[model samples]
Structures are given as structure tokens and as C-alpha cells.
Target chain A: MAKGSVVAIDIDVSRRLGDRVIAAHFTTGPGLTALFGPSGAGKTSILNMVAGLLRPDRGHIRIGERTLFDGATNLPPEARRVGYVFQDGRLFPHRRVRANLLYGHDLAPPANRWMSLDEAARFLGIDHLLGRWPQSLSGGEAQRVAIGRALLAGPEILLMDEPLSSLDAARRGDIMAVIERIRDELKLPILYVSHDRAEVDRLATQIAEIGE
Target chain B: MLSPEEWGIVALSLKVGGVAVLATLPVAFGLAWILARYRFPGRVVLDALVHLPLVLPPVVTGWLLLIAFGPLGPAGRWLESWFGMTLMFRWTGAALAAAIMALPLMVRAMRLSIEGIDRRLEGAARTLGAGRWHAFRTISLPLALPGVLAALVLGFARSIGEFGATITFVSNIPGETRTLPLAIYSALQVPGGEAMVTRLALLSVALSLGALVLSEWLVRRTHGERQRRGD
Candidate 1:
């Protein structure tokens, strides 16, 4: 791996879904890597392993010289400092936009607010939505909030799984701008996932097509 | 024709059942999450046993309660010695019985709601640096609010109508333990107490209907919010 490179070594994981293998072999790399494939093609599984949500049967994940997952040294998601944004933009429904941003801020150590709550909101164009409940947000708006929340945590690397796949065409266009802006503004590396060729071309710096 | 003595029973019943439901909500939520999200040995057995009270005759449940919470029982004895508190024949004892009876209902409702929540949301939380408990409090708990409210209402309704278990475990001590159902049963046995029975029965119907309407309104209101968000 090159200096400051994010590398995911050969990974093998399997789960018996009533005698059938639900997931199998998976491996990939960093720098806006795209896990492009059809539904149930094990794309999400690969992302989950990288995020430490699913422990791999055998593999290693290293991001920017930090060992996130290895045979004997497996770090929990929080400790790994790997930020993951899901396809559905899971904003805390009860919390105000500002509070949701602060939630991630609070979880990070008190070193320096690398991305302050105000900075995150402004960067994501969600400053006006700081006081509104998530229930009041639009589909595209919620995705932006989810991304802002992830960024505010000051993670070393960000993983987004089809962040725009759920939005309408218009909404998808609007969110694409926010996504591109964040990618350029933040020095941290990102691993974005999507099966849409247009979206993959638009955002990804490198593409790793799965099951192709 | 309910005398003031009977009126006292009405208030006592509401007091016990209301407090019991209130106490069960938080505990039930925790247990429900454990059942809904985690996989562990004996989980199936634990799930079945939680519903045992629902399947068992209320009388049998009452007897078990009596044995376990009677003055001579171990838990009851410890309560008396350690906290100078007594449960047998007290209104608190009736509340305890109602809570046990209502617990499974609350857990079931919460479990369903928790299951409905997207696990991917939780995954997002974990990557955002939330610990397990923090993720639950901030993400899971909020998303499952509608279900939690429904559970509270259902548990409260179940506690209010409980009769056999309440009567058997706590007995019908008029001033201390006799709740609405016990009072209605006692009134039925008296001569010329027809008017009182009619009044109490009406009250029960009114209370239950009010809860049902409240739950419906709550469900509609939350559903609207979710739809608007999706839009």
C-alpha cells in the first residue's frame, strides 16, 4: 500500500441463510472505491466489513496507515474512526438537525472540533435546517444531513453506500452537488458505493465493480 | 348507586394500574431491544416465557404471584426487612400484579416497532462513532416512538381490565386494593346494586374506547410525519 493509502485485503465471509450461502468472497481498495453490482450481489456486505459492522471470516482492513481489522486486532467501528453513510440517510427522527450534528461531535474525543457543528451545517447547506426535526426534512435534505453528521465526526475515512440511490432524479441531482462539494472540501478519503453508471462516473475517483 | 366507598375503589384501581404501566414502559423497552436485535442462547426460551403469563390462566398467575410475593415468600420478606415495605394485600401489591400481567404486551409491541426500524440506520450510527447504548438512545429509540406510544397505551388498557389476578393476589381490600373490576364484581353480588353495575360498566367501556381512539390518532399523526419526510 502507498503512503496514506486505504487498502482492504482479501476478505472471506459466509452466513447460512437456511442452508444457502448468503455472502461469500469480497475484497477491494480505497480512494472513492465503488462497489457496483446488482441487489444481493454482496456489495453491502463488503461495505459492512470495511465499516466493521460484520466481522470478516479472514481479512484485513487498513486506512491511512491505521489497522482497522486484522485476524487478531479487530477494532470496533467507533474506534476505527470510519464514517459510514447508508443509502437511506438515517437521521435521528426525534432530534433537531443541530442536535444530530452535535451527536457525532459529542462522540468524538475533546481534542479539537476538526469540523465544528456550525462548519458542518454550513458546508452541507443545512444551516437553515438546524432547528427543524428530521421528520420535516425532504429526502434529499435528509441525505445531506446524514452526510453532514458523518463529516462532523472528523473521521479519517468516509464510506457512503448508494447515498443517492433512493432519491428521485431531481433530488438526486441536487444531492450530487452537495456530495461533490464535500468530497473536494474534505481532505479525508472516501469510499462511495453505487451501481448507477452515471453516478459512479460523476463521483467516484476509482471504481471497483463487484460480481462483474 | 355507587356509594362513596365504591368511588374510592375506582380511584384506587386507576392509581395502581396507571403507575404500573408507567413503570413497565422503560424496562419493557430494554428487554424488547434485547429480544429484537441480539442473538443469544436461551433467547427462544426467554421469548416463550415472557408470553407465559398471557397464555396462563389469570388465576394461576395470581397464585404464583401470591407464592412469590406473599409475606412468607423470599422476595416479600426481603422487601420488608431491607426496605420496610410490604406488598401482600396492599395497593402496591395490586400494581405489581398488573405490571407483571401487562409486561408481555408492552414488550411485544416494542419488539415489533424495533424490528420495523432499519438496521442500516443503526449501522450508520455505529460508523458515526455512537456506542451501542448511545445509538439506541439517539437513533433506535426515536425511530420506534410510534410503537412505544402504542405499547404504553396497550399496556395501560390491559392493566385496567385485569381482574382475576388482581383479586386473587391482592384480595379485594376495599380501601387499599379493590380496583374498578373488583368493585364491579362485588357490586354484582349485592341486592339492588344494578344501578352501580351499570355505571361501572359504562365507565370501563368509555375508558377503553378513549384509549383506542388515542392510539389511532397517535398512529395517524406519526405516519403522516414519516410520509412527509419520505416525500
Candidate 2:
């Protein structure tokens, strides 16, 4: 594994579910790297490890120049500037759309406020939806909000864990366009997890196949 | 005739129960979060012990409190020496007994609510730079607020109706430790005071119904928020 600009992430994480083993070994760079695998192939686990939600049994994870996890140095999720988008959108239920977006912006350092709340809303096409509550959002709309929230964090990297899995095909198509727009706009790295090969082909510049 | 003493009993019961519940809420929330979200060794044992008051007779709970908080007990002596406070045969003693009885109910309701929240929401908070407590305060606590409110109201109602533990620990001393339930029990024990007990019973029913209505309103508001969220 080379420690250089070309590889934005280097991970070798293994987890066991009783006797079964779901393991991954990969190094990904600035563009989108999709982890394509079957169900239960540990796609989500890898994303969780990168986001510091699940500690890998024995491995290391580094994003850019910072070490997010190692056997000894497992940075808590808050300390690791890695953004995560769960499949269900996971919007803060009590928060209006603007407050949810601001929640992320507030956590960011002052220097990262280059993308103001207004800019973030405009970028995500969510300006009109800001005052609305989360329950009012369609599946596509909610995922778009989730993406904007993550981006507002000024994270060094973003991890999407099967974000379109719960949506209908039509909804997924709508979000795919939003995601592509995000990729074009942000220079940050993204580790996208999905079992769908078509999504991988459409979104990923690099592909890491997990499981058998 | 409904005497002023009856009103005193009602006021005392409300005061003691409300104070006890308010005092225990922060602790109950902490315990519920620990039980619902974490997996530490002996956690199951701790959880079971918290619920022991529910299963054990209230008189037994009172007996335990008496042993630990009686005038001659070590805790009682320490409280007197350190804080100049006493619990034996006092209204404070009744509050203590009620708090112990109400704790499990509060914890259980909060625990269920905490568990019901999508864990992914907390994970989302963390990635947004919230530490554990921040995540809980902003994400977990708000989402599970309906359950927390339910727990508090249930605990308050339970404390108001406390009898066995209050009688055993604090005794039914008028104007000192006699709660609504204790007053009602004493009235029933007398020859002609049964009519007085009937009025008190109606009061009890009214208080409990009020609490239930409040809980329902809170739940409806939270449910409406969830509906708006499209969940």
C-alpha cells in the first residue's frame, strides 16, 4: 500500500459473523470507488468502519493524510471528519429541513462556511424545502436533503451506504442525478457502497468487489 | 363534612410526588440510555435490579428503605452529619419511598423509547461532529421524547397513589407524612370515614385521568412530527 496522493483511502478490515467471514481489502482515491457485492457481503460494514460506526476487528483505515482507525488509534466518529449517509436518509425527525442542514454546518469549522446555508440549499435544489418538516419529503427529496447535510459538514471524505436501497427504482433514478451533480461539484473523495452493478458502472471510477 | 385536613393531604401528596419525580428524571434518562444503547458486562443484572421494585411488594421496598434510612441506620446518620437532613418519619421519607417505587417505571418507558429510535440517526449525528452526549441531546433525546414524557407522567401518577411503601417507611402521620393514599386508607379504617374516602377516590381518578390525557397529547404531537417526516 502506497502512502501518496493517488490513494485517498487505504483499508483492510475483516469482520466475522459467527463462522462466516466478510472481509475487504482496498485502496481508493479521489473519485468515487464503489464496493459492489451481494447482500450480507459486508458492504455496509466497510462503510461503517470508515465512518467509525463499527470498529474493524483488526485493520487500518486512512483517509487522505489522516488516520481514522488502526488497532491502537481508533478516532471517535466526531473526531474523524468523515460524513455518512445511511440508506434510510436518517433525517433528524424533530428538525425542519433547514435546521437539519444547519446541524451539519454548525459542526464545521468557520473556514468551511464558504458554502453558506443558502448555497448548500441552492446546490441541492432544496432551497424551497428548507422550512418543511422531514416527513413531508418524498424519498428522492429526503435523500437529496441527506446529501446536502453531509456535504455541509466540510468532511474530508463522504461514505454512502446503500443510500438508494430503500427507494423505488423511479426514486433512485431521481437521486442518481443529484449524486452525479454532487460528484461534479465537490472535489472530496466518496466511498459509495452498493450491491447494484449498474449503480457501480454509472457512478464509480474505481470498483472493489467484496465477498465471493 | 370535607375538612381542610383532606385538602392538606391532597396538597402534600402532589408536592412529594412531583418533587420526587423531578429529582429522579435526569438519573432515569441516563440509566435508560445506558441500558438501551450499550452492551457492557453486568448490564443485564443492573437492568433487572432497576425493575425489582415493580416485581417486589411495595411494603418490602419500604422495609428495605427503612433499614437503610431509619434514624439509627448508617445512611441516615451520614445524611444527618453531612447534610443536616433526616428521613425517618418525615415527608422526605415518603418522597424517598415514592421515588424508589417510581424509578423502574420511568426507566422502562425511557428505555423503550430510546431503543425505538433508529440507531442510524445517532450515527448520522456522530458523522456530523456531535460527540456522544451531544448526539443524545439533539438526536436521541428529541426523537424519544414521547417515551420520556410518558415515563415522567407515569412516575408522577404512581408516586401520587403510593400507599404501601409510604405507610411503611414514613407512617400515616397527619400533616407530616400522610399522603392522599395513606389518608384514604386511614379513612377506610375508621367507622364513619368511608364517605370521606369516596371523595378522595374520585380525586385520585381525576388526577390519573389528567395525566393520561397529557401523555396522549404529547404522543399525538410526536406522531404528527413523524408523519410529517414521512417515516
Candidate 3:
């Protein structure tokens, strides 16, 4: 019956380069928290562990009232109910945009399903591109579709790991604006990892600066 | 025009090859998926076992199959006792032998395709409330489809061309297990059978070439689909 204590991580794992260890311990309530750090700072690594994609060498991860990972209990990624938008968009190449967006909806509990297809598409400004293939989309359009896909999955927490880093400056601004809109309107907890200080400043309510 | 007897050999070869590919495909994909996606102990041993037929001489492979699947063998006896099925010297046994010969190529092609896929896509699927099976079905399998098609083509072609393994496992018997290659071999053994030899030889070449062309077309279609979508 507890909510809003979205993510608690006290873990140590090798950074992306695998040369050194980065230890982190933090807890954030419902809001957009930015993990700002330089390249190779292990921001994505931490996010990955949250999504159950990777396991921390030693630590506990509690999202909401659920103990996701520890010595005893390790929930699979599918059980975590975390939505992730990657840097590359990672949209299903063979699936049409609509199908990609609805993939998570297929498995999400009905009670937890809040966002509709039209609502997600319109919010992300991808209503018209739903029929097209992901490979055909421009960088900005693809990222929007990715966001829409994640949103439709009915996730308890959204993880954006430099979702805009691959976009050009103009596209970056557009995506950042959409992300801000999501944070304000959805009120879901998010861990947005990025190196752009301005992006962190503009959208993040809480900032955890890592690396240089 | 070919005689019924000549046509039977052609028809039998096609049937055996087609059935072999169908049977091998499920096993090939399962093994290929495991080899490409998971890293566990003795993975190399499993890989080696799958590829053993390819490396060994065809006669040796067939001898091994005969020992394992022959009516006197434990597996053969169990199958006969339990299911009333007998693989010894039957056309079905020919198909099994052909499937074994074709399996390595199919697995190799499928494994390459599976490996080429981005694992991160599956990761994305998992976060979206998809379990391991769902992610594999929607993401991994679809993305690797072109490769799978290619594997099927390769398997089919290899099955059609299968000679040594089939003859070794199940001896040539007309109307039962005498496929194109076996028929051709029999024709060559008879005196003044040079014309029948020529005809069967032409048929075998045409069939093998047809499979190759079909495989090539499949691979091209996949590539075109990907390119059309701008991948």
C-alpha cells in the first residue's frame, strides 16, 4: 500500500568500461530525477539494473513497495513494470509503429492500463506515423514513437537513458519538450539519464550528478 | 516424357527432402536460439554435437545413424514397441537421415541471423511487461526472419542433395527408399543403363538447382523487405 517511493538503489557495479567500480545509493519520490554524468559514468548501467536488464554485484533495489533485486529475490525485467526508452530508439524493426506501441499493452494488467493508443500517439505527436515502419522514421519521429511505445506499456516508472542524445540539436529540443510535458502530465516517476546540463536543468526536479 | 518408375524416384526425393526440412526446422531454431542467445556450461559441446554430421564423412554419419536408428538399436526397438513405428529401410528413415545431414547448415544460418539481431531490443520488450517468450516471439524471431528463411532454403537444398547419409542409413529399395540419388546409382550399376543414368542425372541436377534458386529468391526477398523499410 505504499507508493511514490519509486526507486531505491544502493549498489556497486563495474562502469560500462569495466575498469572501475561506481557505487550509488539514492531514493527519489515521484518526479523526474536526472542522472547527469559524462560518458562512461555508468548512468545507463544503473538504469539497466533498475529495469532488471543487469544485476548489481551487491546491493538492494526497491521500487515502490516491491523488492526487485537483492540476495534472495530477483524479479525478472518483465515483472518490474518499468518503461525504458533507449538512445537508439530500439523500436521493433519488423513491427509497424502501432504494433510496437501496443506490444506492452498486450501483457499489462487491465487495471494498470491508463494510457490509450490515441492519447499516447497524440501526446508524442506520432499519430500520423503509426502506420509506417520504424526504419523509415527520422530520428526525432522515431524517438517520439519510442516514447509512445513506452508510455502505452503502463509502466510504474519510466527510464529514459539519453533518449535524445542521438538526435540533432533541433530534434533534441523537440524531444526534451515532449519529455517535460510527460513529466508534468503523467506524474509518473522517471529516471532520465543524460549529460546535457541544460536538459537536466530544464526538466529534472531532482538531479544526481555522476562522473565529471 | 519420363516413365512412372523414373518419376517415382523424383517424387520420392522431393517428398523426403521437403519432410526433412519441415522436421528439422523446429529443432534447428531451438538449437540456434540457444547457441546464439545463451552462454552456459558445455555450450561448445552442444554446438559440436550439432555440427558433427557436417565435419564427419557422409558414410560415417550414416553409419552412426544406422547404429542409433536401426531396428536392432535401443531407440529403434523402443520406437517400434511403443508406437509401432519402424524407421529401418523405410522412406521415413531416408527423410530422417536427410534431416540430420541438413541440420548443421540450417542451424548455422539461423544462428548467424539470431546473433546479428540486437539484444537490446529484447531488453526493451522486457520492460514493456513482456516475458522472455513474448520478447523472443515479437522481437527476436521477427527480426531474424530473413535469416530463418535463408536457413530453410539451405536446409531444403542440403536435404535434396543428401546422398551418402540416406543410402547408408536405409539401403536403396525401389518404391520405398529409393530416392533420386539411389535410383541413379542403381541405373549406373546395370549394363546398358546409360540412358536412364543420363535422365536421372539431369533430374537430380535440375532439382538441386531449383532449390538453390528458391533459396536465393528468399534471401533476396528478405533483403528487399529490409531495404524497402529503410533498414
Candidate 4:
């Protein structure tokens, strides 16, 4: 574990999907901890548990000194203050990029907000696309906006679930560079999920192999 | 081309229909949201109750409404004592009956739209720090707007066409409760009243057709918008 680790989690959770039971248990003291595994390895489920979108049957999740979930307490997603970048850029279809990016920023308390909308937009190179709708943007641009939206919420930790899988090679490279900046520049803790070993090797500071 | 009396009837019909729709819109949306989002023990029963007005005889629905909302009944007595209001043989009673008749259609339209929304988007909103109500207000509700508008229009059309319920609940008193359908019915009863009945009936058909066309157009426009956006 790195000195003054940003996140620590040990959780056990399972859910039944038809005949299959998907389950995950992991403990990490992290920089950017990547859960590397195959498609059905329950990596996303672990992230969901960390973000409070899923409940763990046992164990606990802690960010710094704050307990997000344990045997007795489970914070809801909104209260957990986690920035989540989904596989698909789940931007609001009705909103333009500016509003999508600002949605979380405005909901965040002023004392907790770390970056201005313009700063985050410029950092993600999405400042030019603010007026455009999510549907009008290419997959890459939309993903970048998704990241900026998450970051502007001033989360203690970020969760990225195979955010590069849908992009072309060139776009993947661009987003990988952005992820590097997030890890190095902002130094935000991240729990990333990916099946691609090469991607994990390049981006993750600590890799936790999930499943077989 | 209507005489002043005929025009008055049309205006009255519009008033009752408009009020009925406006009054029912929030309640219908609430019910639709609940039905679309949750799975409770008696969800099916609640759903069936909402649809009861549609399947039951309109007169029966009206009779139930009369029992509940009459001046001497529980709700009616409370309302009379508290607000000094009565739905008894008044235009307001006609509006109430029309609204009840229209509720099922409104709820169905809104419920389908609410259910069709990608709940994942709401999850994303929550991860972005929006509370449940905030996510619903800003995300889910806007996405469901076209359906809500369609519901309102459909409910309005249904309200104007409501005759059996309105007459059963409030009776057909001219000016007070005689809407388009009731006016046509009244005209049909008099000697040499065919011309008046024909005019009112044509107006009724025209209004209902216009509403249905508008509702269809709204639904189609939403689909076209979604497709064009490649959603």
C-alpha cells in the first residue's frame, strides 16, 4: 500500500442473474487500482458496491476515514460522493453538454466543489463542445464530457468502467492520455475496471486481478 | 356558424374539459410514476382500480362518484363543511365526472412513457449527486414530457365526450352542466331539433378528432426526434 493511500475497500457482494451468481470480494489500498478480469467477472458489480449503487452482503468500503458502507451503514449513491464514468457515456439526452457537465457541479456543495466548469472542460478538451447535444457528439467527445461531469462533482474517488472499450484506437489513446492526467495531475483515487491487460498495465498503479 | 346559444354550449364544454384535464394531470402523473417505478404487493390491484372507470359502465362510475362526492356523503360533506363547495348538480360536478372518466387513459399514456425511460440514466444522475426527487424532476420527467402532453390532450378529448357519467353525476341542467354531448342529447329530445343536434354532434366530432390527431402528432414527433438524434 502506498503511504497515505486514498481508498481502502473490502467488500463481499453477490447477485443472482438467472442461473448465474455473480460475486466479488476485494481489498485495496490505492492509487488507481484496476480490477482486471474477463467480461463476466463481476468487476462492474464491485464498482457499483463502492459507489453505493449495490449493497454488499458483508464487509465494508472506506474512502480516507469516511465509511461509505459497512455492516450497519450504507450511504446512498448521491451521498457517497463518487464520480462514476460509465462504459456508455450516460449523458442526459435532453440536456446539452454544458448542462450535463454542470448537473453534478451544481448539485455539489460549494465547499466541496474543486474545479470550475470551464477548468474541467478545458482539462478534458471539451470546452468547444459545451453547446452541442450528447447525441450530436461522437463517442469519444461524449466520453470526455462524461469524465468532466464526474470530476466536477468533487468526488473523493472516481470509478471508470471500461470507458475506452467502445472508442476507436485513436480515441482510446486520447482518453488514456486524459486518464493519465487525472491520475497524475489531479491525483484523484480511481477504481478502474478493464478486461484488456495492455490497457490495465499502462494505466493502473495497482492491478487486482479479478476471477480466473 | 353557431348561434350565440350554441356557442355558449361549446364554450361551457371547453371550460369543463379544460378544468377536468388540468385537475387530473398531477394525480394521474403521480399514479403513473408510482406504477412505472415500483413493484409493490398490490400493484396489480392498484392498476386494476385505475382502469376500473374505463371498463365499468360510465353510469356506474358516475354513480360511485355521486355517492362519494354528493353533499351528504363523506367526502362531499367534509368538502361542504370545510370549503362550502358542492359538486352536486353543478358544472363542477360535471367536471369531476368527466375527469374520472378521463383518468384511466391519462394514467396509461403517462405510465407507458415513464416505464420506457432508461432507468440507468437515473442511476447515472444519482452517481452525479442528484437526489431521487432531483433526478426524477430534471431527468425522468423531461424525458417523459411528450407522453404527459399526449395524456393531457387525450384526457381533454375524453372529458368533452363524457355524457353518461356527467349526466348521471350532475344531471343535464342547461348552462350549469349541459356540455357538448348533453346539449346534443337535449336537442335530440325536442320536436324539429334535428338541425341543432346535428350541429352540436358535428362540433363534438370535430373537437375529439382534432384532439386525437394532435395527440398522435405529438407521439410521432417525439419518436422522430429520438431517431434523428440516433438515440
State the TM-score for model 1.
0.81
Task: List clashing residue pairs in candidate 2.
Answer: A134-B229, A135-B228, A135-B229, A135-B230, A136-B228
lDDT of 3 by residue, A1-212 (tens): 11233444333333334666765567676778888666767888888888899877777877667787887888999988888999999998888899989988878988777788988887788888988988899999999999888888888788998888888999988998888777777777888988787888888998766653
Q: Rank the candidates by DockQ, best first.
A: 3, 2, 4, 1
Interface RMSD of each: 3.0, 2.5, 1.9, 2.5
- Using Cα atoms, each model's DockQ against the true complex is 0.46, 0.57, 0.62, 0.56
lDDT of 2 by residue, B1-231 (tens): 557988898899999999889998998998998999899999989999999999999999989888888878889889989999999889988998999899999999889888899988888899898999999789887888998899889999999988898888889899989988888888999999978899999999999999888877877777775675553
Task: Score residue A1 of candidate 4 by CA lDDT.
Answer: 11
Clashes of 4: 0
N/CA/C clash count, model 1: 0
Judge candidate 3 at residue B195 and give its lDDT: 95
What C-alpha lDDT values do all the predictions have? 0.79, 0.85, 0.84, 0.89
Stretches of candidate 2 off by over 4 Å are: A1-7, B1-3, B189-195, B228-231
TM-score of chain B of 3: 0.94
For B121-217, candidate 3 gives per-residue lDDT tens digits of 8988899988889888888888788778988888987887888988899989999899888888898999998899999888878877887888788
Flag regions of model 3 displaced more than 4 Å: A1-19, A70-72, A210-212, B80-85
lDDT of 1 by residue, A49-112 (tens): 8788987666567664677777788888878777778888888766678887787779899662
TM-score for each candidate, following the candidate numbering: 0.81, 0.91, 0.91, 0.91
Q: Of the true interface contacts, what fraction does each candidate have? A: 0.64, 0.78, 0.80, 0.69
What DockQ was computed for model 1?
A: 0.46
Off by over 4 Å in 1: A1-31, A35-41, A110-112, A126-139, A167-180, A197-203, A207-212, B1-3, B39-41, B71-86, B228-231
